[model samples]
Target: MIAKFTPVLLFFGIVSCYNVRKHKDAKVPGNANDYLDYVLSLARPIIASSGLDPIFPLPEVTGTFENTILGVHWHGNVALYNGFLFGLSTLTRAGDATLEVVGFRMDFTGDVGLSNVQAGYRCHYDVQGVGDDADINVLIPYVSARFSSSTFLLNTTTTMNSFQILNIGSPQVTFQGFDGLDWVAEAIADIVLDNLGEEILEALESGISDILECIISVTSSDDPNLSIDSCVPVRNVKVIRRN
Candidate 1:
């Protein structure tokens, strides 16, 4: 009878060991929300320490505007320089996301340009003057982006799936020139936006990609399993704006 019971006890012991092994080999459930949070959290500190936020001393821009009002010719040439961009913020949402879909909104502000302007009105008398130190404020609205990522073995890469400009904010330009005529300032602002819009978006994308690359590189350096080089490309990204 003791020999017969020994076989049953042996079977139970073998089954228990197999169950433990199975549990050990099983993969943990993936949590994309946590993944997003972790990476973004790491990014903030890295960006702060690296001094990548609040870009300053923007490139200078110049434009000229001419028009005929009531047969009186009006013209001006202006230059804007020494701009700064700040107030960078990201809009986060509360929801569960898969590894395939991650989205967020980015917003910032720019204080651009002390200007030097030369304007004149010609009809009967010549009115020529120079204005100094114009004030301009650029309000960058929220831009939404959708990104996707995949991990194979120890490598991971993120791609910019899509982006949209929800609203385009107008720049405020105050040029105390032409004896209180603000239209020149407005025209100059329009020109600035046309060029600066593209530049700002490009800078933003590059900056973000660099931050992500830094995060991955630092993390991979610490973990042997994730040491492989990975690229995050954000090129040729199209923008869709709301009508």
Candidate 2:
């Protein structure tokens, strides 16, 4: 009887350990949209107190494309040449708790004499912390564009040019934990761009700046329960143009 009971006890112990491990590994189930909804629900009051937009405006987004061409000819004293231009645009929303970015948008414009143009742009933010005292951070927003064109006034010719918004500085902030604990931490996120044009680049920069300012003004406000200790802004904007 004693030997039989010992084996049964050992089997129960093993089962308990397996259950504990499974619980530890279990994660909260949800997608990006669900996470955003949870954060917004907890941050509404804090955002309003920051003196920013009382009602966070959901961003409006859109995009478009255009192509154009021109030609001329002259003989002996005659020359022939042709050119074409294409453009695209995109608008989006970005932000987090300690930091919130909105009204994010970009436009791409390219000129080509006799060639095809391609481009893409992407923007996203990272948020860290738990509950209301969470902190939101911005990595770096960027844009890039390339153009290829040709001429045939006298002979076939091709030219290629590329540009990028660079020197992206990081932005971050720390908020008091909701439980009023002294625990503090930091987070980071990044904005990526590929094959974009100048007009779109400028639009994207302006939109990102606006969103950052809004986040700073709102998150930095005074709260009786939770308060901000410090603040910093990004410096040194970089732009690169290449062939």
Best by lDDT: 1
For all predictions, the C-alpha RMSD in Å is: 15.6, 28.0
lDDT of 2 by residue, 36-124 (tens): 23323333333333322111211211222222224422111111011111221111112221111111111112211111222222212
Off by over 4 Å in 1: 1-30, 89-97, 101-129, 157-179, 216-243
| Candidate 1: 10-residue stretch with minimal lDDT | 117-126
lDDT of each: 0.41, 0.24
The TM-score between candidate 1 and the true structure equals: 0.55
Which residue pairs collide, candidate 1? none
Top candidate (TM-score):
1
The TM-score of candidate 2 is 0.18
TM-score of each: 0.55, 0.18
lDDT of 1 by residue, 1-243 (tens): 001122222322343334334443322113345444555555554443443444445555666777688998887776665555554324232234443211121111111111121111111111235554445665554344433333321232323432333334444443333343556656766766775665556554566555554443433232444421222333332222211
Q: After best superposition, candidate 1 residue 136: deviation in angstroms? A: 1.5
After superposition of all CA atoms, the RMSD between model 1 and the true structure is 15.6
lDDT, residue 126, model 2: 17
